[model samples]
Target: MISSTLIFQSEMFSDWIIYNDETHGEYLVTVDHSEDTCYCTCPDFQYRKQTEKFGGAKLDDNEHHCKHIRKVIQDGCS
Candidate 1:
């Protein structure tokens, strides 16, 4: 299994898909263009989203994103 996160995107497409590896297993994180946001199956993402919503804490902001999402962007599409 791939230990590191894998990012896939195309120049023509605004959406991105990441193959993220977790302790339990691997999950896919999709950056949906229509929604203009990223969604992940990992619990961390869900919890953070809800916490940020209620806590009014900006955890995933412009310069910050979930580890999975950050990996995708940092890894690059090329």
Candidate 2:
């Protein structure tokens, strides 16, 4: 079950900033629910076309959900 707290703490859910630490550097990450995916400013997303193919796995953890999204649900529920 998705927790309401997770929704409250998510930058994606709250219109805050989201970023990813990459090999090259840090890049902004954006979540697109309509498409059920995330876009990062990193080279992996920009040049390789890996983002579209592996976006879901990259975001999901053991719970089959992204950490950011999970945080939002937890925070929102709390």
Model 1: residues with Cα > 4 Å off, grouped in runs: 1-24, 50-64
**Residue 49 alpha-carbon offset, candidate 1, angstroms:** 2.7
State the TM-score for model 1.
Answer: 0.49
lDDT of each: 0.48, 0.39
Highest TM-score against the true fold, candidate: 1
The C-alpha local distance difference test score for the whole of candidate 2 amounts to 0.39
Pairs with backbone N, CA or C atoms under 3 Å apart (clashes), candidate 1: none
lDDT of 1 by residue, 1-78 (tens): 223344555443233444434444565655544334555556667665423332211323534366655665565522
Predicted candidate 2 versus true structure: per-residue lDDT over 2-48, tens digit per residue: 22211223533232233333422333445554444544444544554
Model 1 scores what on Cα lDDT?
Answer: 0.48
